[model samples]
Target chain A: MALAEPKTTSQTLWIERVPPIWWALMLFLLTMPAWANDFFLFQVMGWTFILGMIALSLMFLAGYGGMVSLIQMSVAAMAGYMVAIFGASGMGDISMGLPWWLNIPIAIIIAAIFGTLVGALAVRTEGIYTIMITLAIAAAFFYFTRQNYTIFNGYSGFNLVVPPSLFGVDWRQPMPFYYLTLGCAAICYAAVIYVSRAPFGLTLQGVRDNPRRMAALGFNVTAHRIAAYTFASVIAAIGGILLVWQNAQIAPGTAGIPAVIDILVIAVVGGITRPIGPFIGALIYVLLRTFSPDVLLAFGLSGERFKLLIGLGFLAIVFFSPDGVLGLWERWRTRRSRERDPLTGEQK
Target chain B: MTLVNTTTAADRLGSVSSGNALELRSVTKMFGALAAIRDITLTVRSGERRAVLGSNGAGKTTLFNCVTGDFLPTGGTIRLFGEDVTRFPAYERIRRGLRRTYQISLLFNGLTVADNVYLACRGVSRGRFSFIRPRENDALLTRSDELIEAVHLTPWRDTDVSNLSYGQQRQLEIALALAGAPRLILFDEPAAGLSPTERAELVSILNGLPGHIGYIIIEHDMDVALRVAESVTMMHNGTVFKEGTPEEIENDQEVQELYLGDGHE
Candidate 1:
């Protein structure tokens, strides 16, 4: 591991060489719970990371593949529902009482399969049509889960969905759960980054950029798009598992239209093109959701109206910089780099 | 056991069946009431350099599209090598070593020149389905760099297609066409937007390519068309009007009166 292989530009962009900023951020996240109280650790930062993971999955699809999938939350929520139903948690006569080993993989696999199916149906469509098809499917799934009581347990969703005990520790406890979420997020982040540099990911980006050109160059464009959805589904499914653990519940609202769209907002707000942008967007969103209520109250507005600020923020970001916060950062960096070295065009 | 033996023998024969690189027999394409291409019977032998020369709206581009499977011919059979690929999609044609450049450069403008060529290389390579292997490590990607050098775009190799000059994009476009290890390549209006110098460079590049690469060039520039192609087919009003060597077509009184012999030439 110590002997480094010389890397290409794409390899350098990947997880091969972890940046100092990322290292500092990871260290801070790892040690945060020790100093921070339960509310900050579990409710604030932990939930933020879970949402961030969900958004990151969306980012992976839209950013690299030029595919905007609205069914990402549906995939995640499907996994959450799987955890509730399969692993000894659902209400009377609903739970399957399967082992954790079976349930977890089954949840992820099913979500991946569902995502691929959605991709297959939507892959041929472009732009607005793709968005509409995915949105419609997500809405249909939401209603199906909400109305179907026999299997899904209906409007009053399943509760007491606890994580299994492993290594003599109650995995759902605050510190452990936080670590579990952080670890999964880190692995998923690395995997997404790694895959973006991988052959499949690069080809996918080509397909996204020019599907016709890609197809003419001998690539199976539909297959690549479907495969991207499958990869994105796995990321979302893992986040779903963490979400059910964090909240100890699963509901149709988990996959509802607003939640699904929120994932897209987080991705776009952070920077749809950058891997870390979705998480940063998620952080900004979570911070707003957490404290905007108080800020609204001081302005003699209802706490529920905090959502207005979020909406406005989204509009402002879209209007000013369509690429999101990351785009702004990139433009600024380029200008600075140009000022520093006109001849070389080197960036810091 | 007999079936297995027959299959192996057939596969061996199939690898190099007949020397014809491309065969289009009475191919026609109709769009609504208009026939875009009409009974285009053309055969390109292995290592053949041919030109499809005509005025604008001669259906040369349409013929390229039909042959490349951008759109299926309404009438006849299109064959690649020995295989009947009339019903094959564009991508399938590409997989079978049939490649073409567009009249308008259809490149991934957001991606780098290296990335563009890398994609072209990856498309035909056996590891096209590899999910985890980084493209940077692919032996084919290294080969794509050589293609960049071949087209004289090495200095702009890492630059984005959108940022490149029109001439450079044209160069990358040709590089991409060559990246697929194609046995047959259709160059559609390769000199469309190029300066005279760039046009000469393109002609030189085409000249330098391996002779085994069967090239069907759709060129408006008679100088370039005459220089690169040994034989020429002149199309007028969606039909082949004249077919002969560059000199024969140039000197033919009928061709001069009807099309190429006009002031445009």
Candidate 2:
């Protein structure tokens, strides 16, 4: 069927169409950390935020730009490597060293340039070709980092980079770092929301839904897609820098093809339809990856098989909810709300 | 065989009275062995109401594509407001005050009817690439309201376009094209798939178009065409078959034999 407008005036503006349940969920996330232990808070929650940020960039590209880019993680890894190479602790210790301030901005700029170039090439193709092109580029970058010890520091990768500090606060600490990460994530999330509502964002959606018509309406579809990729890359790069600071290292393994695929899984599991889905999916993955072995050991199972269990869980979730966990939650909430007010119930 | 034969001045095309909004010179589009449009020449003057009538494969849509920059013509010159825009991109054409509506309604289905109109209006009212705020200025909203009023869609303004009936969706598409306040507008089969009453309403809307905005409408219905258009260009076999007023074309024996007469058999 041809695309039709959904009911309701405000629903058209996706940024302003937040349901009450989402707002409640967001509040719950902010206030209910009292139950989280230190390990759960620092390692599980922290990694979730970082991975989620990275996945959100892909979500934006896929959901809005209608372009699925598999190299988002590789772009993030590039940012991580930049931080490792330029941060005070990483200096010649990793590769070619540079000042922290100078390198940080330069790395981001370089990532944006690379992303724009990648987008210009990838946007020329569509569907599976787009995926393959991005994957190929990611694979090439991975091999470049793995074999080039002179620049990338070889298979062991770069380490010893630390988060910078200011105003008498050590940002790398559990609480301080969590807040820093949260702040950055929030800003990136807001930026995505803002761009999606902008004219460029609207045009991208038009192109995605119907390119032939958009072309007739006088839009350059290729240019819009490239701009979308470049914008998403900026967000992914920021997440990469944050991840490097959190882990104090960067490695070729961090951006391998398999790792890039895992990012896609996170985005799909959480919900590609919305920005927050990445965070939710990341939380689930980090929790299982961190605790699955211990939980299995208690049951007399080998920790070596933990990955198999996570894979099963991933399959189960996708089979049950193709739109992801968030879609399921949305459906369930709508059902419950309808049950409460049969007379006034309105289905979306 | 010929009917209401007129002097060359009528076909001379360019004159200062209305001034040329768009001019096509020897435009031809070829796809390997086939020429989709061949040596087509036409002039669209400001405030002209022109209908492009053609059977299937007459190159009506392809000609629209060339004018709108969907594809560059294989050879020719296209001018907008007397300036050469033959090589300009589609978006640039829009930026320079040209806009179009599709045969099938192209409203943003997820957005409200008002939002769809507002977006197009914002494109024109607010400078292109301005990212200052979520909604454009209230002045722009006021203008959009005026446009919504003009298109007779104020009642469904708040409805999501996806939820609107097919007829309403078409109206909304016209509203969207009008939102750009374009100097030239192209309507592709605007009356296709409409109910009889809806068709009449659409024709009335087209006929009532403001004097400042020139329109090029593609229509299959000759009755509606003759009523709304002051001039008509009929196409056959990928080229202009006849160019004249509705009555002159109707009285022409060759045109009638090819289409409205024995051709109907």
Candidate 3:
């Protein structure tokens, strides 16, 4: 009977649909620059948002599209390289000194095309084959960037590739960069949420569930998969651009195998099922990578043991809850709800 | 049927075609040393209702797959509405007003019934990749609702497909095939696991389809098949064994001794 009721009016008021906790979280993030120190704002939160955005792209492909692509980090790196080569950079001879407006869009478009090409190759396969194919492609990009000196600069990459001063605001400054990344990350998160319910996203999920059925329904499954990669690459490309601006540098190691794998780890550890999961995973990863060294040194152990600590934590979390932190949170919430009396809201 | 608007592109194509909804010439599918379907030649007229009857391993499903372009025929050409589509992909064929249902339910388990039907409706129509969610008055949304109601799954419209019962899933399968404006449909065992009541409802639904749309059903249930189909083509060992009216096929001595006498009921 409830299904018979009109859903439009209720759906239109999406602001009211968000939980109160999310509003509080947004408020906290908006005011973070006032309370957070420079190191925390620029290094910790900025890095978290940048990495989270990239992981979010991976989550979009893996969670919704049923494609666990390892090429996201490489796509992001490609964007970063494009910015360095096309925009002003320390490598004055190699950099063409194009306008920021021209370079930024060029960077995103190139990365998306690369991603679409990768999708064309990878979508021909399924499941584990997809992962292997994407990984191989990512590896190829890494090696190419490392060996090609003319365009990519090989070992030493371009630096001084800072964000352009727009409206007299130096965006590379801690507060501005934090806000910039925060704004971009929020837009990406909201966009993913919105598109997940759109026709394209719904059909992508259908393709994931049953490609044959989707074909029978008249959907070009391969084309949909490729389009998904293009969409994801744009997000990853944005994140990559922000990353280069934050560090004022771009290098082959930025998109190396370890870095590419880290994006996958971040997506999975954050619970690749929902859009927020990638951000949550990135926050934890950033916090651990930032503070765990000092934490280990305080215990009189070598700071290099931080990787061991991270590995242990990753193992424990995965062992306990394969869906990641979001899964655990959902389980706890459901359990709490079940314990409460439905009519009176009293704990049982 | 309201689903089959006469002015639709598929109907227009139907009118201009040679009137054969589907034509297969010397179609053959081979997997290594074994031939799944061999030298199959068949034709169905526009708006014709035909049932393909066979026992297990009769290549009925394989033949359906070949026609729908799920599996490419190793040898012959398949012409849908007078257009040779032997090299066309599954979606290409589907876009040319062809649709099919699987023997086993191939539904989006994570999606709701309404979403599933809406996807089918979107697949055939324009703006399939639109980022905007459908508004309440979206034509496709209304059509999907009509399809859901047509299949009698209105109560479960918001229910996830995985949560639906077998009979409900079967109904949804039929609704999916009927989406958009299909000029030809291939049904692989629509009543395989349905309850008797559901089978009767399915028969009624099949019979009630618009006259411009044609379908070939692969069925093991003789009663359900004969009731809905005007003609019957019996397959044995990947080849056409008999072809006649349902009554003629039922009374034929070879069909009875080889198929019916084997207790297929």
Off by over 4 Å in 2: A1-35, A90-102, A215-218, A296-301, A337-348, B1-18, B124-130, B263-265
lDDT of 2 by residue, B1-265 (tens): 1111122111232223338888999999998999999999999887788999988899999999898888899999998877788998876677566778887787778767766765666554433343443443355555556667776787877777788989888887787776654667888988888899999999888877767778888999888888888899999988998999989877878888877658553
Q: Write the per-residue lDDT of candidate 1 for residues B1-265, one digit (tens) a residue.
A: 0100112111322434678988889999999989998998988897899999888898999999898888989999988888898998888888777778988999988778877887787787666767666434556656767788888887777777899999898888888888756777899989988999999899899998786677999988888999999999999989998899999998888888776445744
State how far residue B202 of model 1 sits from its true place (Å).
2.4
Best by TM-score: 3
Alpha carbon lDDT at B221, candidate 2: 88
Model 2, position B238: C-alpha lDDT score: 84
DockQ of each: 0.43, 0.23, 0.58
Off by over 4 Å in 3: A1-12, A342-345, B9-16, B262-265
The C-alpha lDDT values of all candidates are 0.84, 0.78, 0.90
Candidate 3 clashing pairs?
A: none
Q: Between 1 and 3, whose lDDT is larger? A: 3
Residues A1-348, candidate 1: write the lDDT tens digits.
000123454446546567789789878988898799887777777888899899988899898898898999999999999988988784747988899999999999998999899999998898899899999999999999999999888897789898999989998878888888889888998898777766788888888878888888888888889989999999999999899888899999988988988998999999988788988898889888888999999999999998898999999998988999999899997788777756776653
Give me the displacement of residue A223 in model 1, in angstroms.
1.1
- In the range A213-322, model 3's lDDT, one tens digit per residue, is 99989889999999999999999999999999998999999999989988988888899999999998899888888889999999999998787777777888899999
Best by lDDT: 3
Candidate 1: regions farther than 4 A off: A1-17, A90-92, A338-348, B1-16, B135-137, B260-265
Using DockQ as the measure, the top candidate is: 3
What TM-score would you give candidate 1 relative to the actual structure? 0.91
lDDT per residue as tens, model 3, B1-265? 3855445435544433787989999999999989988899999998899999988998999999999888999999999989898889998888778889999999988888989898998888887788987777788888888999998998888888889999999999989988888888898999998999999999999998998888999999999999989999999989898899999998888898788675654
